[model samples]
Target: MGVRFSKFPLCWWPSSIKSNLHDMSDIDDGNKNEKDHLPGFTEYSLDQLRSTTSGFSPDNIVSEHGEKAPNVVYKGVLEDDRWIAVKRFNKSAWPDSRQFLEEARAVGQLRNERLANLIGCCCEGEERLLVAEFMPNETLSKHLFHWETQPMKWAMRLRVALYLAQALDFCSSKGRALYHDLNAYRILFDQDGNPRLSCFGLMKNSRDGASYSTNLAFTPPEYLRTGRITPESVIYSFGTLLLDLLSGKHIPPSHALDLIRSKNFLPLIDSCLEGHFSNDDGTELVRLASRCLQYEPRERPNAKSLVTALTPLQKETWVPSYVLMGIPDGSASSNQSLSLTPFGEACFRRDFTAIHEILEKLGYKDDEDVANELSFQMWTNQIQETLTSKKHGDSAFRAKDFSTAIDRYTQFIDAGTMVSPTVYARRCFCYLMNQMPQEALGDAMQAQSVSPTWPTAFYLQAAALFSLGMDNDAQESLKDGTTLETRENRN
Candidate 1:
């Protein structure tokens, strides 16, 4: 069992990996709650967040504007297989670190079903990043304006408005009155396709500066005059979003108001929604939007009032949002193996033979060094021994002598001359073969710490967790592995 990991570059990972291992311990001890909610507010280390997002790779970017945007968000998977959206701010965005922490901690205290809740924040040196729940279905901007499958249904639009209103109302009740840059982009759909307002807007971008990033047409009138955001300003932005949902495209508030005044409702309404709603229903929604777009911020209705008005107009309230959006239901899809990647499918079925075949085919591809030139470290005697141990381990693993593989791999690991996720992954597989699920799990988690985006590490973890009878966690790991594998293939 030892494999030469010298080909893989050595990395100085942060203590976040230790934190993740501690969390795993909690899970093993049954101390974690099984409910669908974040445990508590976390002040994550910058290195930890960096590892989760694969060093903030462009391939994992989820922001609508991609890398060009002032603030960029990337999709990341935690060691526990939970998806997170990490928003990295510009260097000078939050100069006051203490102020940023205060804002993030306050926002993280909120736990609302209508909001894509803040989970943590990272403030180390010049780095400032916020972590929140990741929405798989994408933003309202994608579904409402640039739909791929089909335009959002009328019932779903109504639900979006109501849920957003509820989210704002919840924030207001919590003494957090101001929301910055509220727009269709701030709205995202959860796994169930239900809309939830992004919690990122709840925090101030700077201590004392302008926060609005959208065009003046979408900006609240009061904000233009004073360069400030208030509760009523959020309501004004909500009205513009109403216009977006009513019409198929982005319309300036002034132009939409003009269309409303001329009673030219035909151009203002989305053509796809024509046969879906009654004239009275459209008129009622139009009336609400007009009220929200009033010239004076004080004249706009509060979040609760908007919620009340939109609630009655909701159609098919009993039906699931995923059903109306024509997306796959997460619960139903979790049981099916048809859409899983090859590695994920093997893990899901616990087919060790298939897993071994796939791993052998992979053969430390990610472990290859970037440069062909040799380094001074390569001449060290310790490096030679480490390479020898790994070579022996690989031979044993291939020959199905798992016990020998384990001993050789342990020697390489204890050498500390090199760090390789492939080594940890191989050792994890060996442990699994020896029927030591806990040992297998430790190695798998270690592999993730060394290389966060390695799909094989996640797949091995799934197999280990399944052997331990942690089927739910195993399924989650399988999903993450499948997603990462798909993304890798795309790139």
Candidate 2:
């Protein structure tokens, strides 16, 4: 017979909170002011929400666990045809209506592109609900673990890491750093297929103690010891997320660390991503994850540092939402369309000579657009500028002028058109030499993003993490670097 596990509480509030219930009226007023300032937030009537959810029909239930769960979530369509996800707190979850409203309002005030934007809330005498923008692509868990079609691409996974870190950074900046349940399920994919952190995690529950819906192994050590989560604890959770992205399985942190120590990451990586990522990219991500999973919360890198570390791993920060979602372009006869544009086809094929011949024959010799079309002129110009800047930066780097190298590389990066991995790697090295591990990590990540297969990026990242005293992560990076070198030698 299977052992049935009891449902965990949603959140923990102090026992004294009930005694201070009268003061909650003042809190409600403050929440009102917050709600007023929150541009898109709304106080919806109970009837409106009920109607939208088709009277909370079972068919509307969308929560991963289903309607019987403690806090049920439903996908609903509003009268205006706006799709939304509504969370209906169990009656016992928040008995204090005022407290619930105040908490909801506080969370509603938070706004960021990475967050599933809260749209409205409802608080009747015995009913409480929070509504957020409906995510079309489902939760990250479904795509990562139980994908029905194709698995998530390596590029998309890397992008998710950067986006998630930025989201955490934004939340940390907004003073909402303590996420109640931070996990893959908390990440939902919006209409554009971009991952978004669910805002429901921001709301504080009325339960008297810390809650854990997941396994204790995944919970931060501090939460197990003190039964409370801090900002750094959230960072710790973020580290677990990195592990999730890398492993594609729910391995315990301790076990993961053991695997890292053993240099046994090959088995940890998902089979679906076998050839999708380079050894260096995997190693760098693992190392960053190890830092986040550090036993001491204070020792973990902050959200900003995490953002810097992950930013460079992104392949294209501005990929169209549809492409990220893997939605097929509906345009008919794409091959015929391509055939009509010989210049474009030639450019796509990287046949510069053919492109130039076509442009010259088309009588557009002087036009900048034609010039660019002829020989990828814009990219060529940007490369020339990048090379010039990189040369100066390389000179400074060789001369032991770390600061100047950083400055020159900063200019190169600011130009925003070049995608040179060498520049990023050199700048990362300079940042490390100058004792700027965070910036070094960022540069290393950028290098990897620009050239995912390059081993040097991993080596630089490992060096920076080592300087920051993140030994496990550094070791992981070294392992990845070695793997990449081995692979390169074999080729």
Candidate 2 accuracy as lDDT: 0.70
Off by over 4 Å in 2: 1-39, 208-210, 316-318, 328-491
TM per candidate: 0.62, 0.60
Give every collision pair in model 2: 312-445, 312-446
Most accurate candidate by lDDT = 1
169-208 per-residue lDDT for model 1 (tens digits): 8888888878988988899988777788899999975853
In order, candidate lDDTs are 0.81, 0.70
| Candidate 1 to native Cα RMSD, angstroms | 18.1
Encode model 2's per-residue lDDT on 87-204: one tens digit a residue.
Answer: 9987767888888888888888776668887878998887889999887777889888887777778788887888888888887877888888789999998755668899988877
